[model samples]
Target chain A: MRVSLSEFRPPREGAAAPALRELRDEELIERVQQGQRRAFDEIVRRYKGRLNNFILRMVHDPLEAEELTQDTLIRVYVHADKYREIARFSTWVFTIATNLVRNRVRQRKRQPTWLSLNPAPEDDEVPLDPPDPRADPSRQVEREELGRLISHATSRIPEKYRVPFLLREVEQLSYEEIQRVTGLKLGTVRSRINRARARFRRHIKPLLRNEALLAELEQIEARLAAEEGSDSDD
Target chain B: MFCRRARSFISLALDGALPADRTITLTRHLEGCARCREYQTDLQLGRRLLATSAPALADGFEWRLQLRLNRTLQEAARAAASAWDAPPAGAGRWLRGAGLAAVGGLALAAAVGLFLLPGEWSVPAPREPGVPGALVERNAPQEPAPASAPQIAIVEAPATVTSTAGDPTRTSVSGQSRTTWFGREGTGRAVDLRLSGAPDPRGLLERQGWSGGSLEDLRSIATLRDQNRRLRDALAQAQREVILLRAQSDTARGGLAADAGGQREAPQTR
Candidate 1:
């Protein structure tokens, strides 16, 4: 039953067979559950990128996010039999990732350690990885500053708001899905996402003061108002 | 007062959760009110700015994660072997043979392998000259392998009528599908399911989280919650009924006492 990757072609529209990478998460996972080691590898290949980005945003530390993402996938492998048909595989994975993030955050707060045992003092804070040198230097600086401000604003937001906000905005999960992920009421999730977005706006607005942004806002406001008037009339 | 509360509703409005009337009111309010409009702009700016700055995974992210997972799994295997090799001083549980464990694991793996065998997905190929493409069950489809042909491993798994990639609703070309196929003349060949990269939506879902519990555990918790709610509701109704009956009994007792007093007064008068 262990088909060679050479023979592992699924039915696709144009190709003679679908590539291994084209397999759905559920399909890969199903095969994994059925003792296909390569299937699990496929899953790792698919989710690692998305999971890394999500964890990085939440933890704000690159190393920790990688560790947490790895741990999450490991859990998926060991507990493949625990997933049910009722929820999406992605939801389950995200939930695991989020819970791990929460624990890491809680642990960090409990024992505040800014520094770890390292031979060199200079290794205390790892800087952001280098930017593309060929790109304009000034633009890179501005983008970096903006990126840092975004990260800072996100970190400053309360967890109650931040969790739903990140899941909705970054992960692109629906409000109902956010409720499932966080075990929060629908209303509460919406409210928190709203507050988180608003707070983010407050933090970053000063950095991005442009007349063009204001002009766009005005246009959106007008369009919404016209639609609102029609809806109210009805 | 409307300004503060409307701000929260504005988020809902933006998300298209607000009702028609509320949407109209909020929009009209935005048109008249500059402060509220400013609040709306902030919301938009927040969303627009964040959307512009999505995160990218660090370089070598996948390679490192894979390396870590391999190391962890190897370590786990080592730990298991070590535990089996040396049990605690008093515990007799370690007496179980590692060979038996190995057999069990292999057997489980083989069963899983058998379940995934591509032969199970084969639609019955007609070997006879006049076999119709109509909905007729090829009850017995398995054929004895000739010396030259590769052994086609038939999956005894339930007949899953998987269709071609173009149409999901259409059943597999096994004509009338059967859970079990019998040995019949001429209907020996089958084209099994060609499961490519498409997701099997019918695939069972199982997830375990940091809570150290399965989705089943969460489902059971939800079921227990429903039962608790029903019991609480029943208790509340019973309590209400008890109060109503007690009041009625008290009223009857009062009437009886009044009647007794009237009779005593009549006797005194006599």
Candidate 2:
């Protein structure tokens, strides 16, 4: 059985029959090339949420994400002839979104008002760990707090690592899909994702210093270890 | 496994990339290691948090997109239609050719008026004093000068440096020299050229095939006249063709209207 990249996505929503939505991405694009507006509408419906979230995480701006998402789709419509079936449609569209966000991020960097809340590593004369969030009585690592921290940390990671990292973890793209979307070597993808994971952990570690989650983590780890031991014994 | 290697494996395991066998070892390793366990927990927690953190798009996203797409497509269609509906190339070319010929004829007329028209040209006497307002009559050929004396042609040139046109003090170089021509504060004198020891003008004009009676010059003028006539004829033909095209266009439009009316009445009768 041949697995396609589209399998990684969730099942389509709405009462639209699987038979109708079942048109292959390449076929839909061909229909669009033949001036079928319905086919292009199907494409926009399918990729809008995924592309928007991917771009949102990359740029950390909602409005820019929406604009870039629309721009990417319009480009697909305008230059539909440029697309080839050599790669999956998801991969090609994600590549376009990545490039658009990359250019926007580069332009933002040139502006003086574009500031990151996180301090740079070079700002430290001596390597001091980030202040523990647990030390403050007012700052509890609640669900919302944790979500905010994760979002902030995700944004704080260098864009190079952040891009591939989001494509892998949040978007749930496979390693190979990430390699295709980012146009990075497989080995580079692995290392950058690993590095991004480490940085993300470091950023949120102080917040996750809660005793309850650690106790839960320990129980889960112990159960997994026992299962592994039983499988080895058998 | 070493803590560092175990951390990497744990990261891959979080992404579901680790092999099953390595997963077991990583589980056992995590069981033994507190630091690696914390690392795995942080990654999982962050991943879970990120899932819920994706921003929801604003309302009416698809509607807005549809609106933009319509406007964009309409613009593209309009541009394409204009390109397709442009006038035919042959008619435009003929029209352009006629306009260029008319411009060329006007330019040729101006050149003839400037260079070949009879003007107040006089040859200065060799002994006349070189003064600003001194006028010399056209030298009579019967009174011949010495062979060694140079023959010079003097033509009057307008002094663009000062007010010469419509000025009451304007000097006419037509054998009438106004002594008070340069009396006004801003009025300036005309320009004069006295080429001494130059070659004879008549001999030079004959050598260059531009003498008054030279056949080559007359033939060139005749050729220009013939070309002007041909261009006028071509212009007339182009105008007639344009009128014909307009008439054909109007006839086609009328036929279209009649056909449309017939179709409308047929549908009503049915």
Candidate 3:
């Protein structure tokens, strides 16, 4: 079966690698301000997937994520003069993205009910089938259950907690950077992450016990690791 | 430090967010306490699961972003170029200079025309003395001059008398004409003596009794003629001054035009 880009890359191996990559975001932004088209291209290449995924999770629509990503980059170009070194460039960029997402959500709320006939693609539908009993069904079942549980739990999270949770857990932003991006206090960010953790645990604990789900998760992990190996080789 | 405050630190410790020394202490404490230890494991597991479960974005997202940046840069460049190419301040200055020169030229022409022309002077051509005899015969009879022989027979004597009747007193006083010949010596001066026609000189003097009346009339007429002559001379002088002023005005205008032409041509020459 053909794998999607989402399934290709493994989780980041070490914390230090992302930290080093993040140090370049500011340099790229400076170059963009100086009219370096290639620097802007590099920035898009670096953050497009991550920003798209973040927006996709928030909006839950691929087309909307694509459009919002474009809008985010355009906004960065228009407002590049306003970028300051006091905050990390990634935090500033994400702040713009989050604001756009919030506005899109609000606009969607104000639109008439008839116009909203097309719903977002159902993320809850599991792609993998139930494992055979003859096979290592227990682990396969566990991974599938865990995937469904995670999707449901994250989908249910309110925007306020979901945004902080995504930034902290998925984007892996520092607390101070999250505060800058979300315009929330450090205390509030910490509490929201704690609450998101509690909610995530409540949803995932039952699914974590499935033997088949665990096996499927291990298989997914191995595939992800192999993809990462290939990417590093490239 | 306080009873309830330790819970906040416990929460922080679960997130691996406490200070280094505090983290060590918190971890040691958590190892002994099952509840805190469970909380830490739950938090770590939640973080890991959330990280893995979130979807990754589509590929080649950066390329689209770069395209957008390029388009924006182009738009900005176009705007800058247009702003730079707009008409400049020098054009306005040149227009103002041209307008001022035009107004000044018109004002100078009008001033010369309105204030500089001679007043009440009419020009007449010179006439020959012989034309008077022809003119007199066409209009009326001519009076004959006195002759030394006194033997010329004049058949137009009646016509002369009839014509002189229009000046009846002069015709009636032909006997006394020789006495006034000395008084008509000065240019533009006239003397009148009617001694023969008057019946009584004392009665004539009594009838016009104002003292020095004749002398005053002659003096007043001479003064008026002199004033008129002075006025004519002054008017002619003023007209000449006006002509000179007009010439100067024209010359100045030519100079201004030449200067402006030079300025215009300087750039071409360069």
Candidate 4:
């Protein structure tokens, strides 16, 4: 059966058995060196999604993330000889992605073309429009307030700190690994993560006092619990 | 305690980099201090939320990447195959041909000199009678004989002349006729002499007139000279071949010695 790329989405929870069943990254790399097309395909199958998401978080553009991910894979193929077994394949792959992201950011700074594409302000800004009269007032108020808080908090954090923060808090990479990917010192990586959390907290504090943030949090927890139930059934 | 260093330590503790003992101490301190506790809790909560929200791999990204990688591998394989199949460059082919030609020319010259030259000398038929007879006739006086001279005169006169001289080897005929006979014999002898003459036979050939005898002598000299030159050239080529072969052999031997030494040293290293 042909397994499509879409079918390879990461399981939300860890699957120890599948991880064991898959070939080790180094073994896949060796196969690639020997001109095994399938091996390279397997490698791409293993890393592409994770890498794409990682790049997406950094660039915040799905198209650009996809392009950068493809570029990273191409680099891996071209410079396969340069890979050393000493470093984990994930580290090496992320290093390539990070470099590309950094270059894109630098290029944007110089050219400023990306400024126009800044994820439409409307997409980021919480709608100030009043709730529909027919809608339940409590539900509408909660949704509006939560949306406003998340947008304000996420948008206020500078891109530099936001990435490290997201990566640490959201992506869960260890400080050393983050250091490897970002070419930052361990100290700097931690500081960025800390600063990102502080910024997030400052933005959310005002909205959190309104009680809607707490209600939204409860709703998220309920959704997660439902997801857990379905996962358990599987 | 909440200094810059302490703040940095707090960040490190949040990242799970603090040693176990230090982490415990930091945790205890954070629990008691409201401000620090709030900071630590916020950081942890933010990190957890972000981790949960970080995007999962997009649909079909892995498959597309796989396809690209496969194409790349195939292209590299084809390139390698083509390179392996292509003919070697012109300089390599030319060098190989030149080396063969040089070795062949040397071997040919060596065979000709070693086998043919001595064989020519060992031949008895052409060397004895023709050479002696030609020498004797050349020494005799030159004289023109009548075209109608009888066959008996030639035979009987030599017998009579030998009897008169009292030595069968010594015989005299008419001066003019004898001169003509001697001239022909001398030319014939010269032809034979030129074949195995001195190192430089050209000097001897130059004295002879351009007649059939002289032409024969010149041709024999030319042939011998050519043979000598070929022999010398072949010897030189053989010498060069020997030197090259020796160097190659020595190199091979050296390599073998090195390999043997390496084998001998392996056990010691282990």
Best by lDDT: 2
Q: What lDDT tens digits, residue by residue, belong to model 2 across residues B1-270?
A: 799899889878887889999999998998888988878877887675566545556655665564454445445534433432232347444543433243223323333333433342121224234446443222323323423433222222222223334432333423211111211222122222122332332344345544222123333334434433443344355455434544554564455557557866997899
lDDT of 4 by residue, A92-162 (tens): 88778778888997897788463454563343222233333544656545544544445446767898887
Q: What is the lDDT of residue B186 in candidate 3?
A: 12
Tens digits of lDDT, candidate 2, A1-234? 111222212222243344547898888888666655556768887788888888877877777888898888877876676788888777788888899898998888897765568874354322333444434333223433544556787788999999889888766778898898888999899889999989988887765776775564455456546755864464
- Model 3 per-residue lDDT at B216: 29
Q: List runs of model 2 lying over 4 Å from the truth.
A: A1-18, A23-27, A111-147, A206-234, B19-28, B77-270
Candidate 3 wrongly placed segments (more than 4 Å): A1-23, A113-149, B1-11, B20-25, B32-38, B58-270
Each model's DockQ?
Answer: 0.14, 0.12, 0.10, 0.10
Docking class of 3: incorrect
| Candidate 1, residue B157: how far the Cα is off, in Å | 55
Better of 1 and 2 by lDDT: 2
Give the per-residue lDDT digits (tens) of candidate 4, residues B183-209: 111111100000111132333334432
Q: Rank by TM-score, descending? A: 1, 2, 3, 4
Worst 10-residue stretch by lDDT in candidate 3 chain B?
B181-190
**Model 3 lDDT per residue over A200-232, tens place:** 666677655667755665676676687679756
Candidate 1 per-residue lDDT over residues A59-177, each given as its tens digit: 99877888898899988976887887578788889999999999999999999687766675244333333454544655445445555677888888888788898888777788888
Weakest lDDT window of 10 consecutive positions for candidate 4 chain B: B186-195
lDDT of 3 at B69: 46
Q: Which stretches of candidate 4 lie over 4 Å from their true place?
A: A1-22, A34-42, A112-156, A159-163, A204-234, B3-7, B56-58, B62-270
Better of 3 and 4 by TM-score: 3
